[model samples]
Target: MPERKILAIIQARMGSTRLPGKILADIGGKPMLCRVVERARRAACLDGVLVATTTRAEDDAVEWLCRERGYVCTRGHPTDVLDRYYQAARQAAADVVVRLTADCPMIDPAVIDQVVGAFLAADPPVDFAANRLPDDRTFPIGLDTEVCTFAALARAWSEAGEPYQREHVMPYLYEAPGRFRIFLVRSARDHSHLRWTVDTAEDLELARRIYAHFGGRDDFTWGEVLALVEREPSLAAINAHVQQRTLGDQA
Candidate 1:
C-alpha cells in the first residue's frame, strides 16, 4: 500500500457567536489563526496543513489571510463543518485527517504528533483517534486533536444527519461506539481543569498573556504553558469562568 497522507485541517470562520472574528483576534500581535497554523505545521507526523474555512463573505478574510501567508485553503459549507472537513480531505487526497479548530492558538505540535502516532500505531488500526473524547478529556481544552481515516470522515459526511454532528464533526463516529474503531490519546496527567481555547474575552486575555510571556513567539510548547501557569497560578484563572458548550447545549 502507498504511504498514507496525513493532513491537518484547521476549521475557521469569522461567525463565532461568543466572540465574533476571534480567529483573527490578536495574540502577541499575530492572528490566532496564524498561530494555530504555524504550530500545526510543525507537527512531524503531518504531511501538510490546510485551512478549511467557509464560503461566507465574512470568512473571505480567512481565505485571504491563508493566501497572504502561503497556506493552502479550501472552502465548503458554512454551517455543516463535517462536509467542510470531508471536502477538504478529499481535495487534499488525505488518507488520514487531523482535525483542529482555529480557536486553539496554543495547540501543541507534540500533542498532535502523539495523537497521530497513537492512531497509526493501533493494533487493528483505529478509524478515529483523538486526545479528548467527549467527557473523558485529559488534556487542556485548547490542545484538543482528532485524527480520523478519510473513510471515516466520508462516512460521517454521508450518514450523520443531526445538526450538531454536521456542525461539530466526528461526533457520529465516537457517539455511536461500535460504528468505528476509536482511540483516545490521554495526557500523562489530567489538565482538563485548565482552559486554553479562545471563546470569550477572558479567553483572549489569557491567551494574550501566554503569548506575551513567550515574547510574542508561537513556538512555545504546551508544557511551557503549563509551567508558566504553574509559576503564575493566576494565569489559569483568567478564563476559569468560561464554560465550554457541549453538543447537547449547541443550537
Candidate 2:
C-alpha cells in the first residue's frame, strides 16, 4: 500500500541442528511453519509472505507443505541463506523485505507491523531495521523481526563472506556500524530474557503450552502471551534454563 511491494521472506528448512524437522513441528493443531505464515499474513504492513526453503532433498516436505497451503515457496542453497533471501526477494519483486524464521510459531503480527512501519517511516530510510540484535534487544526472542530493502539484501548477499553472516542472514547489514544504515526498535519494557522461540526440546514444550493456553488460537498478541506467562510463572520456568544460542558461539 506504500507504493512499494513489501514481502516477508521466511527462511525455512527441514534441517536444524538443535531441532531437526522443526519447521514442520506441531505447535497446537497445526505445523509450526504454517502457524508462522498465518500469523505473518495478519500483519497489515506486508503485501505478501513467502517461504524460502532449500534445494536439499530433506526440504521437499517443506515445499510440499507450502504447496498444500497455497503459499509461494522458493528453493536455494541449504547453508547460504543470504543468497536464498536475495533470490526469493528478487523473484517475488519485493521492494522491502522482512526476514523471519520458521522456528517462531508465536511470531506477533503487531510486532511485525511495528518494525515494518518503523522501517518505512524512517526519515532518511535505513538499510535495515530490526526489533532484536546482538547487543541491543528488549523484545522477547521469538518475536524478532528484521526489515530491509531488497537492494540492501542484495548487497549483503553479494558482499557477506563469513559463513555465519550467510547462515544467520542480515548480519552483514548490522554487523558493521557505519557500513550500512541500521536502526534498532526496542520495547519500553525489557523482555529480552523471555525465550519464546522454538529451538530446543524445552523451547518446544513451552511453545505447545503457550499455544494450548490460547486454545490453539494464533490470534493471541505478544502482550497476551506475556500476561499469561506472568500469571502462570510456571510457564516461563519451563524454558528458563534454556540458553538462547548465539551465532558467535557457533561461529
Candidate 3:
C-alpha cells in the first residue's frame, strides 16, 4: 500500500467581491498570501502546500509570486473552484486534501494540525472534516480548514451540479445529510462571533492592526491574538459589524 499524503491547497485569486486584488494585500509588511502560506506550512500534518489559483490573465501575478517564492502552484477554472481543487490534488497525487483560502492571513497552524489529526485518526474514516462549514461555525472564520479524501473530492467534482457547490468546494459532501460522514472540529467556547478573515476593507484594516500589534511577527498563536483582543476590545470591534456572506448569497 502507498503511504498516505496530505496536501493543503490554499485557493487564491485576485477577484474578491468586496475587495478585488486583496490576495496580495499587504499585512504588516508581507503579502497576505505569503502570510497565509507561511502559517499553513508550519502545520506538521501537511505533507505539502500548493497554491491553487486560476488561469485568468489577472491571476498571472498570483502564479508569478508563487514561482518567485518557490511555492508549488496549479491553475484551473476560475469560477469552478471545485475543478481547480480537483486538478491540483490530482497533479500532486494527494491522498488527502485540506482546503484553505488565501483570505485567511491569520490562519493558525495548530488548528490545521488538530483538524488533520482527527481526519487521519478517524476509525470509521470520515469522508470529510472541517474546522468550519455550512453552519454553526465556532472557530473564527479565518481559521477555516476543510479536509477530504481525494476520492470524495473526485466524486464531488464529477457530480456536483450547483454553481455554489462547484465554486465553494466540499459543500456537496456535507450539504445533504448522510451523504458523507463528516467530522466537525468545534471550539470549546463560542468564538464564532469573531471575524478574522480579510473579506472587506475593514477586515483588511483589522488584520493589519493585529499584525502590527505583534510588531510584524507572523508566528503569533491564535491564543495570543485572542488575548490581544480581550485586552483591546476595540481591536475585535474593528470588523465586528462585517457580515459574512452565506453560500446562497455567494451564488
Candidate 4:
C-alpha cells in the first residue's frame, strides 16, 4: 500500500454575505485568512497546506496574498465548495485531505493535530474524520478538522449531488455512518462556548474581543480562549446565539 499524503485545504473567498471581505479583514496585524493558514501549518500531521479559493475577480487579492506569502493557492467554482475541494486536492495530489475554513482565525493547532491523530490512530481504517460534524461535541467552531481519503472524496464528489451536500460537502459520508469509519475528537467543553467563527458584525466583535483578551496573540490556544471566557463571562456572551442551536444535534 502507498503512504497517505495529508493535505490541509482552507476554503476562503473575498465575498462573505455576513461580513464582506472578512477573510482579508485585519485581525491583529495580519489578514484573518493568513492567520488561519498559518495556524493550519502547525498541524504535525498535515503534509502540505493549500488555500482553496473562489475564482471570482474579488478573490484576486487572495491569490496575490498567497503568492506573496509563498503559500499554494487553487481557485475553483465559488458556490460548489465540494468541487473546489476536489479540484484543489487533485492539484495538490493529496491522498488524505483536511478541510479548514478561512473565517476561523483563532483555531487551535493542538486541536487540529489531535483530530488528525485520532483519524490516523483509528483501528483498521478511517474513511473519514471530523471534529464537529454531528454537533454534540463541545469543540469551538473555528477548531474544526476533517481527514478523508482521496478515494472517499472521489466517492463524495461523484455521489453527493444535493445542494446542501455540495455547499457544505461531506454530509453524506457522515449521515451514512456504516459506510465510512469516522473518528471524532471530544475534549472538555472548554472553548466550546467561545464564538470564534466570524459571520456577522457581532461575530467580528466577538473575535476582536478574543484577540483583545489574548492581546492579539496568534499562538493562543482554545484552552486559553476558554480560560479568558471563564474569567470574563461577558465576553463569551458576545454572539453566543449566532451559531445555529440546531448544530447541537448529533447522530
TM-score of each: 0.98, 0.97, 0.98, 0.92
Taking the tens digit of each residue's C-alpha lDDT, what string does model 4 give over 33-135? Answer: 8889998888788899999889999999999999999999999998888999998898888998888889888877888788888887888878888888655
lDDT of 1: 0.93
TM-score of 2: 0.97
Q: Give lDDT tens digits, candidate 2, residues 61-173.
A: 99999999999999999888898999889988999999999989889999999999999899888889999889889999999999999999999988999989999888999
Model 2 CA RMSD to the hidden true structure, in angstroms: 1.5
Candidate 3 wrong stretches, greater than 4 Å: none
**Could you tell which candidate, 1 or 2, scores higher by lDDT?**
1
lDDT (Cα, tens digit) per residue for candidate 1, span 141-190: 99999999999999899999999899999999899869999998888899
lDDT of 3 by residue, 162-216 (tens): 9889989989999999999999988998899889999899999999999999999
Candidate number that wins on TM-score, 1 or 2:
1
User: For model 3, what is the error of residue 152's alpha carbon versus the real structure, in angstroms, after optimal superposition?
Assistant: 0.3
Local distance difference test, candidate 3: 0.93
- Give the Å error, residue 38, model 1: 0.3
| Global lDDT scores for all candidate models | 0.93, 0.91, 0.93, 0.81
Candidate 3 vs candidate 4, lDDT winner: 3
TM-score of 1: 0.98
